[model samples]
Target chain A: MRLTSWGNLSLDDYQTFFYDFNPNLLAKIPKPVIAVGASRSYGDVGLNHLGSNLLTTNLNRFINLDGNLVTAQAGINFAELEKVLNLHKLSLPVRPGTSYLTLGGAVANDIHGKNHHLQGSFGCHIKSMRIWRSDSGVIEISTQREPDLFFATIGGIGLTGLIIDVTFEATEFLGNQIKVENLVFSNLSEFNQINQSSQNYETSVSWVNISGKKNGNGIYSRGNTVPEFAKKITKAPISYPKNLKLNFINSTSIKIFNNLYQNLQKSIKISLVPAGKYYFPLDGVNNWNQVYGAKGFYQYQSVVPEKNAYEVTEEMLNLMKEEKTYSFLTVLKSFGDKSSGGLLSFPMAGLTFAIDLQNQGEATLKLMNQFDQIIQRAGGRVYLAKDARMSREFFESSYPNYEKFNSLRDPYFSSDLSRRLLGF
Target chain B: MSKILVIGSTSGIANEAIKIWLEQGNHIHLYARNHDKLKMQVADLEIRFPGHKIDAFTFEANNLSKTLDQISLDNFDIALITVGELKYSDELVGQIQVSEKLINSNIQIPLAFAQTILEKYKTQGYGKLGIIGSVAGDRGRGKNYLYGASKAFWETYLEGARQEIWKNKNISLSLIKPGPTNTAMVQGRELGNLRLAKPEAVAKVIVNGMERGKSVIYAPKIFQLIMFIFKIMPIKIFNRLSF
Candidate 1:
């Protein structure tokens, strides 16, 4: 088996099987240890396991679309998947923060898109899957054949078995561009009220420009839904990312980077845009991690319930301010809802703030540790996906119902991503 | 039937080995730099296997005195030191300070822990000790020879400590020399097609070697044979293929 990473990977150790296997042809190997998706599914949930040969690059064929039922190999990417779905005038229900995941990966991680509350998780729409169980060997499962494994496989972290191909129902899209409106929240609390007050919109997420400050802190959000008056355009739309550059700098660098960025943003006017443009604003700048420089960066994304938002975010911001750590990317989004079956699923009708911390040495860990304490006190758990390193105890303490999650996990079907983070 | 204390819980091998102890319903104490990541693990074990007691503590495992004091209450039957330094970038190749820290982190600190813990285990009349040594320790090669030197010293120290104490006292010490296990430590680094063992495979070998009362184990079994061949090769020829 061969192994290669996505440069330094979006996070780290994004293990993907570097083989090509056609469903038409049989295997000389065990289906790439278990195929890993586009790797956008944070954590090692999408990583290949030990002694397991993976088929990643080769399994990315997206062939044939029968109505809303799209059939794809394990490696078909989400961006391309979205493009195909849009071609059929449809969209996946829950889109995780990124659209780079494979259909198999999205199912494995059960990714939740921006409009989670209205739709539930990504697994809600999945009809069935063609799986190759290491123990039972290949079988097609849905709500019937091996239904326990199927339900468990939904957010199973790809542990139930290897997914060779997937077929899920898709939501129809209105037009190329969603009618988007920009709502700049002066603070987190304001974002909360506005987010809660509105629900009729098709999609909503707050883009927080949180820099560890009280005022002028929070998101520059964009909410969009299909409008009846919108004209249908035949041409495919393009999205330019706001740039996911978490610029790491000393005091000198911080001032220059923030000043230039803020000034540039002061002029961008409100307008309707493509759904991709509205959602993945930072997708344009390729290798956006370069902004953090050679030291690399840490993306800290945590979900805190609305009740604890004030106290928690206050302490969170206060701690970062005290630490004097500057990050170019800090986003606050009000989560919608989630399914009951999702064991370790994020968001319980709360606000999640994601920030990128450039490696500023021990200080970053200390601040995160401090953030961990506040989050723990305020009843919040850190997101396992974006986390490269976190104490196992803290992870367990936050996730008290892990016994429930662990019970669902197939003994042989443990995720490499969760295993590494937990050091198991 | 041994309740053990795994000092360096972050080791890939140690983590898998701990699972066996958990399965045996043995009380295992997990220690590492980060506590949150392991809470889910130890907690689940504690809850799932109610009889299996798992306690975790976050400490600078490199600090012998601090670790010894913190773990005083838990009189462990085994002390497995899996902490070591593995650096891939050339940024630390020649830097004496960096090398010194690596040696201290991998060798000196573990040495201190061994000296303190082994004395207690010896006095107690029974103990098992395993270290996650590497094939790099089998002999110095061009790549990461400094790390090899540290592991080599550890292997020698463990051998001496084992010999100094009478074998009949029921003390067992095993040096785990796994060739190159597929671990996060070697994720993106270049390790030129050596037979890399899996973490579980390494753990299984270590557990078996401990059960058989073997002193040193080359993980995956094949690496032992491979290293045996490498050990006797002439220095001139070995040096040619060092890297």
Candidate 2:
């Protein structure tokens, strides 16, 4: 079983409907809500909201592919999109964790990627899109057609409207290779400085010791698209094993692995790898989530404005350290855009870090809440797509344009997301 | 705007009751544990019945103290209670500690709201207290005696409360005795000669009894006759036969 909560009523009903019209589907037979997303999200934002959910998987059809101009459905997964574009030597400027989300979902999240400084979010790459307005009918929107819906859809959390299909801008890549570099930062201050200085520089990311709130800053990875000459496929980095949860691998083993990981990251110069390999390391194992075990893991991703980046980073680390809650991957990156179509997004021209940890009870919730408060005050926010838990008040406060987003959403449709998020 | 409150509104029975209220163009206030579950339901229900006014409030029917503190007794015109404990763990039964947990979650806790709500209804001069009880409360049997006993107490309580207020308060209390209808509680066993009633069906009877001002009703009607025949049988013979 994929245990994939697609936020749909029946895997069977969803499977059959290629399409079905419920006279009052949203208002009537709402199923248990579990949000469904690209699974790239850290939390239940995309997990099913209830018994029945709207499936975006099929929204991936390529409606029009004219030369470099391609219009595709929002439900199309990125992986398949990449395969098609790869055949034609084309690339989307906005690429997130993995190619497993609908184009609509991408825009709904207003996803930011490695080259956000240069290109901005996935929304910026979107030239135009067609939305199924709840109040209105289907309308084409862009900077021109229907600006409100267009902007709202860019980061609107699917609340604004249904992203049927979007026209995305593309860039060309020579070979499918991951160009990378590595650097090590000493502490929290150094990491913050590195992130700010690197803006408009490279698609750089860093890993830190989130376990130690006291001295939380640890490792950094500065990377960029290697020049065609430097793009060489060598060997894949030793991928982590599947079906293994190192969440609590004896303190001794954790200490040992931590030491090795820190050391390995510390002594790094520059290396060339496969493009797909660098973009998606975990894509190798089909059911890699199983590594977190049956209980699953919570991915805590938040964005802090440029000014409060350091404090946010410091506080997050200190809380995790104090709680002694360990994480497998604590990654730090930068986001450029201010908003997306979804009512709530995690970007605001700041440093965004995603901490992946095995769900370990109150410790995680407390730490995440502590971090949430900090980010909220700093005028930062969490990505709804990657969120499983958040207060309605907090969510409303986080997104400045929440009211606008709500107006766009079809009040009649009952998505599990709408159910859970709305406190139904 | 008939403000209706449906307690225990997150389950299947609650959903059906909510739908009926919506279909009838009445105002509704849903109550549930997890707010998210109720959120979507309200939205969907609103869609189902476009003009119905609806809202949701949270309450744990078993926690009388909290329910009293949180729930506004006058916020609704009608109070519907589906608050009852139907399940008992073998371990708890064996340990004999279930008496408190089950009773609190089911009996005394819900009964606590009677005076609170009835007082409000009496003051207002007109209101209905529709409760979903069970025929199992008619008499205690061997298998689920604890559950049956709790309902029996509730049934008897309603019967007494009905007389105490009788002529003065347009406040009506209808006891809905829904006899064995196949539900998640009764998973597989077929009730031969006794058609298993659907929750929708049970909910309808409860609604009918409340609307018709009938003090008590056995859902499916046949169950009442069967129970009457059983009730009139000699004690020795009744004890000798299997249910």
Error of 1 at A312 (Å): 1.4
Best by lDDT: 1
lDDT of 1 by residue, B169-221 (tens): 58888888887776546543334344456677788888778766678888888
Model 2: per-residue Cα lDDT at residue B78: 78
User: What are the candidates' individual DockQ scores?
Assistant: 0.01, 0.01
Error of 2 at A323 (Å): 0.9
- lDDT for each residue of candidate 2 in B70-131, tens digit (9 for 90 to 100): 55445567778776656543335665666677777567656766667777776777888877
Candidate 1 ranges with C-alpha deviation above 4 Å:
A1-34, A41-50, A53-55, A212-216, A226-256, A259-269, A407-416, A420-424, B1-243
Q: Write the per-residue lDDT of candidate 1 for residues A313-415, one digit (tens) a residue.
A: 7677766776676766677766665563545655566767777777666877788887788887778887665665677878888867566556545444444
CA error at residue A267 for candidate 1, angstroms: 4.4
Which 10 residues in a row give candidate 2 chain A its minimum summed lDDT? A14-23
- lDDT for residue A314 in candidate 2, whole number 0-100: 75
> DockQ score of candidate 2?
0.01
